[model samples]
Target: MTAGEPDLVGPEILDGHLYDYPAYYDLVFGSDCAAETAFFEDCFRQLARRPVERIFEPACGTGRLLYRLSRRGYSVSGNDLNPHAVAYCNARFERAGWDPPAVLGDMADFRLRRKVDAAFNTINSFRHLDNENAARSHLGCVAAALARGGLYLLGLHLTPTRGPRDMGESWTARRGHLGIVSNLQSISIDRRRRVEKFAMSFDVYTPTRHRRIEGILEYRTYTLEQIRRSVESVPSLEWIETFDFAYDISRPVVVGNLTEDVVLVLRKR
Candidate 1:
């Protein structure tokens, strides 16, 4: 009913990797698919040096956004490390009578058959690189896959310049007979190592069963300076603009010490 409000319905608790449950994961994150697609299209129109058509996504869990973009006639392709998610995405495309585009691959090192007009990886997925070399390598791969002047919209949370702190968020979403109450919290922060650990739990409600799925994950932390350096490490990509999670193209924000959620628009040189 409200943010972080506990559900009244009791659920059977279980520990599991969230990515393994593609259907439930989609329900939690796919609710805003349309809006996010619109924002990406606007970004391409407003910032890309060439007309945007072909698109790519690294770590495209469940292929929700890719499917949405494909329906809008944009050539969309994506890769993910999860076999379940890749299978789920392909099945979804087949059920829709469209050609499947999702493939199994890693985010830090992968290539495309052809260069795309734009690429994106959002919602702090980039932070999973876990180190400077991996982060820079991923950027290099994206740059190599993009046509000259193509845009790569990378979204993630930046560590506060003052210091790291424990924080959390929660939300609820429902689709037909299924509902999801999701909670995500930062369990640990190592400023020296530039890493943060998170615990994510989802209370899933269905007609036949109710279960709580929990997962622990680690993400590499980046300050404003650190991210700037990472971008600079990739010679082909230039950091063009910065926006918050609001996905507003008109309102570019200067990333600073206090900035948390950041969406960086990188252009391939």
Candidate 2:
């Protein structure tokens, strides 16, 4: 770990499960690994004008996509603000006998010496930017780092029109002998300011013992229109199209009462 980067990966119950441990985080979401990677590959094939020999993943938590990209023979590089995530990714690559290019860096100011053919931020990770300016800066930096006419795939939920609503969901996954339950809830949403507050509770179960760790998170919400406007504000990026989580590019984006999330295909101008 670097000087200021955190070395802890969990067991600090109050700090939250995800912030503390990479293994629990992976177990909770790794079930969808195949689907997520397939979506990324599909987008690259459908949109990129040039072959995607290299990819850059910003806010790449746990290197899920990065690992998959490498497995498919694409050169992969990524960065995460969380030092734990960066360290975990590096270790993961090492275990697989592959060199890892993940590092600790802020998305707003991250830069690489070599430009990549494409970049992506998956699973609502981009919403971590709390405001429009921050979001724009992140996009601008990504655009500046990508090759000319290269593609950028961004995925996140679109704010609903029915005003702020509370929602909750839960799912279970296993890691070896341990079983984990991930419970997520939306505590509040500020429609006017486009911010949503949420919480996560992780329950870990062993045969004889059980533990719970919880944490809160906040995200800046974006509607479809706001997303288009934000991209417009980033001079080097052009909005190409939007697809829902299904990753079906043939169908046009339906931004309506029920639309909640989308993956936007953007090009570096």
- Which candidate number would show the highest TM-score if scored against the true structure? 1
Off by over 4 Å in 1: 1-10, 163-166
Per-residue CA lDDT of candidate 1, range 133-187, in tens?
Answer: 8898899999999999999999998888775543989988999878888999999
Candidate lDDT (C-alpha), each: 0.89, 0.81
Model 2 C-alpha lDDT per residue in residues 92-114, reported as the tens digit of each score: 99999999779988888887899
220 Cα displacement, candidate 1 (Å): 0.8
Model 2 local distance difference test score: 0.81
For candidate 2, which ten residues in a row score worst on lDDT?
Answer: 1-10
Off by over 4 Å in 2: 1-14, 162-166, 250-252
lDDT of model 2 at residue 176?
67
State the local distance difference test value for candidate 1. Answer: 0.89
